[model samples]
Target: MGLTVMMFTALGLCWGSNFIYMKLAADFTSPAQMTLLRVCCGFVPLVLVAWWRGALKRAQLRLLPHFLVMALLATAFYYFAIAKGTERLPSAVAGVLGGTIALFTTLASLVFLRSQRPSTAMLWGVLLGFAGVVVLIAPWQDGAAPLDKQGVFWMLGAAALFGGSYVYVCRFLAPHGLPALALVTWQMGLALVLLLLVTDTSGMGELLVHPRALAGVTFGLGFLGTGMAFLLYYALLERLGAVASAAATYLTPAVALVIGWANGEVVGPRELAAAGVILLGIALMQQGRDRSKVR
Candidate 1:
């Protein structure tokens, strides 16, 4: 349990930092290009780890389609939307919006999954969480708040995609008994291929010219954010159940808020209040769960 908690905490910090990295990398390249580079870079290390664990050969080819869908919805389109959104939205705002994955995941499970239904507490949580998201993006606030309608749409879309993918994995993939490392590796590989199919390498030379941007892409997006974070996340999912593992979403906003503030991003009272409400909603959502099985 202690190790699971530690892994969960570390995963939160890692994912929280990912928003800032996306912001940095977006400054240098297109969203599609950034997505392609991230998957390609993350793939190498993750694939190596999968190989070392002797998990790669154990993959069932019948499940390749599922892995491809996971890559598209969870990784490729998800990060592409984030990269584009963060170009207009602040990293902190992006993080808060991203954290709503728990809300969406819960709601999605209730609707699409036969085994998971929402309790009264879960319904209240859903309402509060949505309210918080609205408050966070209140265009009526102040002109100084830096709210972008298009960016909000993009982030919310990404969150929904991620949430749906979460339930999909829990329902379909989890029962298959595949090793998480190999599953993640295969997903990255498929995402790389999917991204390459749409995006070009025209910016490759330009990316090489900017050392700072290159570093952000290499270490921030590739090594820490994608590779290490996913590895930790899969470990937590296996140890703790999906709902419990999703608690990492709560921790990420705090880290992102601090990092964004430290980096000179504007965070007003409304943002803080909205974040608090979101956390409250998440807590309520967790309470509605059957935690005995999770533990």
Candidate 2:
């Protein structure tokens, strides 16, 4: 396989495993506190990289507001909401639901951004993906909860913001000559500062009292998920263009499911079947898109 494919595959595996790590950490910390720590950990390395590459010196201070909004919406709000919602939802369910961000982004772009119109294949792909979600959740099952009614809605809401950020990045930032690594670095750095200001540090302090918990959150969120995965993603973008790079999102949930299963999370036959359908939908959607853009 090409370097791009390898990078994307690595990105998927790292990110998918992140859900389980986040779930584990969430058990020990409140969402805000967890978000704060994770952002801080992620930001530190990025800042070092930016400083080393002199990306920070070239950054326009006038664009601080734009970067701040993107940070708050994409990193801070997106993560806090997911963490909070996952308090009541299972990792498997959250992973499956989270996969809808791609579909949402496609629809959001067509409606709000006046970007690409949904082709027939894309429409069917979205529908199939959503149907797979419904099947995976099994709303009618005696013990199954309503997918849209629980705290999972917060995750969906987060995904919407995430999708919106993706559109914003593609539509506006990409045209302005912003490098993906620089953009992500600044976003996370700003988000870390903002989150630190408002979040109560009592929980964070308490978390440090437990070395294992701190290490788990730090390594998982910092090195593996945000740091390594994003570096690989940007590398893939440079090597393979955006379309192929963005396709990594399709693999994230699968990675999360495998990790969740290994951690003793139940993996039913229906869930596996739904995952297959979802993957099929993603394949169809990618098949219909212009392969030139990164998405």
Candidate 3:
């Protein structure tokens, strides 16, 4: 459990830092190019790891459709929408919005999956979390970016799809004895093909000209953000249980805020306050789960 908490913490830090890296790369890369490169880079190491572990041979042929759907929802749609959204919003704002994934996942689990209905405490926790996000983004604030309604919508769409994909994975795939690494590898590999189908090679050509941008893409996509972080995340979830694992979502925004500040992004007192509230809300929700277990 202790190790799991540490892994969750590290995953939050790495994923939060991904926003800064994406911001840097976005300067030199279009959304399509960025998604294509990131997915490609992420796929390579996963493939190597799966092969090294002898898991490649165990992959189910019939599960190809499931893997393809996972890739489309989790990688292709999620990353493409997020990259495009981050181009318009600040990294800090993007992080805050991304943090809402847990909230959406909980709601979706209840409504669509019919897994568990949230208790009164859980309901309050959800509301508080949503309020915190609104405060952090402050879409109504004067002098803030015009909110980029389209970008916000896209990010939310990505979050919903990602949440749904997770549900599918837990319900169907896990029971079939799919190892996490193998599943992730197959998903990313399929996503690579799907992305290539739509990506503009001309935009990729423009991105390769900038060494720093290329390095950022390589680091964020290949190692720090996706490859290592996801491996740790699955391990942590296995050890710590989902509630503790989910705490990573709350911590990610704080990490991103620090990274954004270091990158000279403007952050206000209100944002800080909002982050605090969001953390409190996440705590409430997590603790509510504990209470449920006890009951």
TM-score of each: 0.91, 0.91, 0.91
The clash number for model 1 is 0
For residues 1-295, could you state the per-residue lDDT of candidate 1 as single tens digits?
7877778878888888888888876767888888888888888879887888788874477899899999888989988898888778899998898889888988898899887767878888888998999889886666564588899999899989988997888878999888878778888899999898889778676878888888887778788788888778777877876767778888987888888888799888988988989989989878876552354
Candidates in order have lDDT scores of: 0.84, 0.77, 0.79
- Per lDDT, the best of the predicted structures is 1
What is the descending lDDT order? Answer: 1, 3, 2
Measured with C-alpha atoms, the lDDT of residue 139 in candidate 1 is 63
lDDT of 3 by residue, 1-295 (tens): 5766577778988888877778888888888788888888877777887899877754486899888889888888889888888877778877777777877776677666555767777778778988987876577778756667777787667777787777888787988988788899889889999989988778566666887878787777557688777777777877876676777777788898888988898878987888778777767876776787688
Better of 2 and 3 by lDDT: 3
Q: Lowest summed-lDDT stretch of 10 residues in model 2?
A: 286-295
List model 2 lDDT by residue over 1-295, tens digit each: 6765667777888778767767777767898888887787777777777777777645566667878989899999998987777666767767766777887787677677765867777878878888887788676888654554666678778878898897878776777787677888888988988898899877567667777767767878667677777777777877878887888888877887887788888878887888888878877877777642344
Model 1, global lDDT: 0.84
